[model samples]
Target: MPLPTGSSQPVYYVGWDVGGWNCDANPASRDALVVLDDALNLVGTPWRGNLRTTLNEARDSRDLIDRLLGLCRHQAQGAEHVVMAIDTPLALPRALLALARGDAVSALGRSQENPYLYRETERWLFQRGITPLSPIKDMIGSQATKGMHLLARFAPHIAACGQWLSDDRTLTVVEGYPSPAKRSPAFAALRQRVNMPATLETMLHQPTPKQQDIQDAWLCALLAWSLRHAAQSVAWPPDSMPAEEGWIFVPVDSLTPPV
Candidate 1:
């Protein structure tokens, strides 16, 4: 069964504040995940930690992913119509040349400051004035690799899946950057509080420093919800999206100053 378009099924969202194995900032290192229901409520406890630790040995990464899959699948609404938004670089950079539409994961060369080795969506984000981290830099450092692994592991789970991606009524996954999106004026006016739907108590329960990830993850989930129902224009057409290079969904109004 697929996610219901009618009001029968409840829609859910997930935000993942991804990191690397050595990410000492959070207890989860490179894997902080949060889920929210249609009412913008946190579904359950946010998951933190590196699967490579407990699931050590061969297939540790796979096991970690399987565990995550279970979490998503378990929380899935009728037909499992969940939108998981991840704060990470979903694809490797696409080739710069006009015709090299081949998989850029193993493409021509590397870039230092730019995302040419990151993904076409990074360049698009730059054009839109949302500067993103250098996926190439993270690639060497071990961050982007985890995101890519998750993407690869989760691609098959997308309902009515697209070629290497999905954005249908069933299950859709999007790349989101909650930090920059939150910087928009719409979010800047908040006083004495983190700009998230999550509770302050919940934020404090986890490591103080990692609260940012919780916020980011929730924001990503919110972005997915918005993309699905409200401003669908926030995300580009799946056809226009890169086949191998994943697309990042940013709020249309959050992109820049209002005219």
Candidate 2:
């Protein structure tokens, strides 16, 4: 599938399903990646593997960073805006951090703001019927940390509005939760009403573990696309939400896919 022509600078959307730190040893648990163009067409063949090979091949830290950029580029031939959506917790709760510092914090008993388990973003999703997992209480600490590590290396600067901006200001990174996002009204509408690529059907019917990862990556890519193109539909966190806590980007039911 090809993107719509005529735009001088193409925008590439990347969705990455983070795996364990040592994902190379486990094929079923390897990280999955999906790249999409502005029109939502697959950019290249989806990739399932870890960063071991890329890191090993590089001569130094700078070379490693270059190789990582190449991996995200895939087959794209020119400079483009890259928006990577990762399915993992990018930050921990503020209250938990405060407590970790041995501050006198009051208990959050039964309150949705459980510092040890839930971030404000997760609680916000819970109020809207989407349950996001916790890195502290859940078994996803490895993946969560992996995502954050990548963010620190690639786009450590957080914008005032909470967007993760790359050092060069070309790449923008966002957090995503595909489990609840796939069930969102926006996804349902996109699946049933949008003019999607033909490969989408094959992906939809298959339920294998690796396939699920790819599907999740694709959904995350969709969120990235929506955030870039359909801003009105994106569920932007309130200004009150701390930029350091991080925010998950997902479109609401009002999303209208570009023609």
* Best TM-score among the predictions, by candidate number: 2
For each candidate in turn, the TM-score is 0.67, 0.83
lDDT of each: 0.56, 0.71
Candidate 2: regions farther than 4 A off? 1-7, 52-73, 76-78, 192-200, 254-259
Scored against the true structure, residue 49 in model 2 reaches a CA lDDT of: 80
lDDT of 1 at 230: 52
lDDT of 2: 0.71
Q: Candidate 1's residue-wise lDDT over 1-259, tens digit each?
A: 2445566655666678777766655453456677666665566666665644432432422334335545543432234446677787766655533236643434343353344555666666665667777665544336666666655554444333121332333445667788666755433332123233346546733436656666677667667666655564354634665666667777665665422
Give the candidate number with the greatest lDDT: 2
